[model samples]
Structures are given as C-alpha cells and as structure tokens.
Target chain A: MMDFISYTCLIVGVIFWFWGTIPLLSERSVLFKLHSLSVSDTLGSMSIIFGLLLKIPREWPLLVLAIVCLVLWNTMLGYVLAYCSSSGEKRENR
Target chain B: MVGHLIFRLTIWFLLTANLSWLNILIGLSISLLLPRGYTNPETLKEWLSILGKILWAIPLAYIEAFDLILRPHNDEDMVCEQVEKKRSHRLVFLDILLITFTPKTIVVKYHEEGWYEVHRVTRRKKP
Candidate 1:
C-alpha cells in the first residue's frame, strides 16, 4: 500500500543520514563518507520521490522525469563537493 | 562479462518503470563508482567521503563551539589557557574547527562565569 512504500523510503532516508555518524561506520576517510552520502542522497531521495509518485494519480512520465532530474542534480552536487574537498589537500601540498 | 551484462539487463528492466529491479541496479552502480585503491584521497570514493564528513560534522561542530578562552588539547579542540605566563597555540577546539575548514578570523567574547561564545568569523588560513 501507499503507507508501506512511504515508510520504506523514509526509513531508508533516516538510515542514510545517520549512517556516517556511527564511529568507524565506514573508513575514517572523509571521501568515503561523502561517497556514501552521495549514494544516500541520490537513492534515498529517489526512493522518497518514487513513493510519492505512487500516491499521485496518473502523470507517470512526468513524475518519473522529475525523479530522474532530482537524482541527476543531487549526483552532480555530490561530485562537485567531493572534488572541492579533495582539491583543498592538493592546494595544501603545493 | 557477467557483471556488465547484469548491469545492462538491470538498466533495461529499470526503463520499464519497474521498482523491483531499481534498488538492485542502483546498489550495484554505487559500488562500481566507488573508488578503490591505495588508502589515500586519490579516488572518487575518498573525495566524496571527505565532503560527507565535513558536511556531517559542520552542524555538530558549530553547536559545540564555545565563545571564550578555553583549555587546549592535542589537536581536536583548539584552546589554550595561558600557562607559566607563556602562551602557545595548543590546538584549542576552535583552532581545530578553524583549521578543519578554511581559515577565518574568529571573535570570542568573555563572560563573568568562565564562559565564551563565537561572536564572529573571517578568512582562510594555512592548512
């Protein structure tokens, strides 16, 4: 049902947000954490959006497109942020 | 070989708007994109993780920051109490916060009850 879908997506989002907080959850590498979060943001958001789409009436194509765009945008942001943080180290080394 | 075919097949199934195969495909893609190599910030995974930690830590760190002169520790929190009438940058909490991000001018105000708060901030510093 709609309730099941929504809950599943939301629970996953919460898990993604809380994932890095655990000590030694992944490696200590900040880059790894960012990588994990990128997955979290993209797929987590996708899950939530997809769940919402199911609740709506018709317009399947539009909803799917919207979800795709959201995923793409979030992925891009993650990429840029990841690069910026690592580039800092390069600058420091120079 | 097998992985590539599976990945492509998953994508084909996904195009049909099938949710069943979506999660599986996304999980695999994430794993593939993750950087693998020497334990350095040379890969995409390492880079993303760093940004993640910084973004994650910011709110918690800003909340914990104090607004006064405080004791210094190894390198986490940058605080230094004047000892033996000699001063040293003992890596106070704030200092660590400052260096952790970009450099900045931080303003601290002192209160009567051994307390302080971050009042202001400014520019980049040598990392």
Candidate 2:
C-alpha cells in the first residue's frame, strides 16, 4: 500500500508540473502565467518530495527541509517576479 | 525573540539532521550569532494563527490548482486590499506569500497607505 501511494504521488506531481508548464506557451500576461506556474510548480515539487519521504523515511529530515524551502522560496520568488514585472510596466507608462 | 531563535534552531537541526553534541554546539552558536533586525511586538496567538493559515493554504492550494486546470479563466482584475495599521514586515511578507501561493491571486504592489494591489484571475461559471 505504501509503495502504491508513493508511486501515485510521484505520478501526480509530474502531471502537475506539466499542467503548470504548458501555460508558458500561451500568449498570456506575465503575471497570469506566473500565478499558475508558481502554484503548480511548488505543489508538484512538494508532492514529489513527499513521495520520496514516504519511500525513504530515513531521509525525512532532508525531505522535510526541501518541502519547507520549496514553500517559502517559491512563494517569495513568485512575489518578487510579479513585483518586478509590474513595476517595470509602471516605469514605462510614466 | 525566543520564537525567532527557536525557528532558527529548528532550521539548523533540519539542515544538519544530526544529534551529536558537536553539531548541536555549532548550530546553536551559529544561530545565536546571526544578526537579527528590529522586531515588532506580535502576540504568539496571532503568529500561530497565521502559521495555521499557511498550513491550511497547502491543501487549499492543491484544490485551487485542480480548479484552475479544469476550468478556463474568464478575466483578470487588479484589486486593492486594505491592510491593518501597524503591520509588521513579516506579516506583509506572509500575506503576499499566501496570496501568491494560491493559483488565482498574486500581489502586484504594496502601497504606503497600507493597501495591497492584487492581481486576480476569475474563472468561468458552469452552465
């Protein structure tokens, strides 16, 4: 059962990664694309790491650290990117 | 102050993943030696509530991601949200983090007037 769940999580994470990346190809606003991309990518990476943690419980500390870093840094990075892009647009308009 | 120290210590232990005395000593000293900025007085209850909200956002984020994938977005809007008076930088940072962590909203700017310029994506309604 554990193995099955681990595999499922890994598969779902990969699917999330693809779902998020596919939007980059579309002609949407930068912030719009970023919103989807950041959300899915962070979720996908966390899910994958969680699956690994379950598979190898011995390395749980590292895996947990990875999840924490992903959540904090990915969110911060997304905000920074959005802020920079929007501020640039404002500068051009003014 | 104590909370920040504990948080740093937790990160140190997570990074080292060891319980050796030497490792503990090093981690303790490093965390203590790190310079900290001025901190505003925030109640522990408020901090924990925010932390709980962040934890809750994880599951909610997954749900929102699925919702985004299944439905097409109808339009995007820029909305301004008022923030509390005497807000700490940490609170503002977490606010932006939580908003952007979810699939539908991203904070564009934080104004001096205690307002956040948020960009949100609205999805289509079901027929």
Chain A TM-scores, per candidate, are 0.67, 0.94
- Please write out the lDDT profile of model 2 over residues B1-127, one tens digit for every residue: 8887899999999998999999999988998899999968788888998999998998999998888878878578889998786878888788888988888888888887799999988874445
lDDT (Cα, 0-100) at B52 in candidate 2: 98
DockQ per candidate, 2 decimals: 0.04, 0.86
lDDT on C-alpha atoms for all candidate structures = 0.44, 0.87
Per prediction, the TM-score for chain B is: 0.23, 0.91
Fnat for model 1 comes to 0.00
lDDT of 1 by residue, A1-94 (tens): 7778777766765664454234237444445444345435554565566766766736575667776566545544544454466568669889
Model 1, residue B90: what's the lDDT? 24
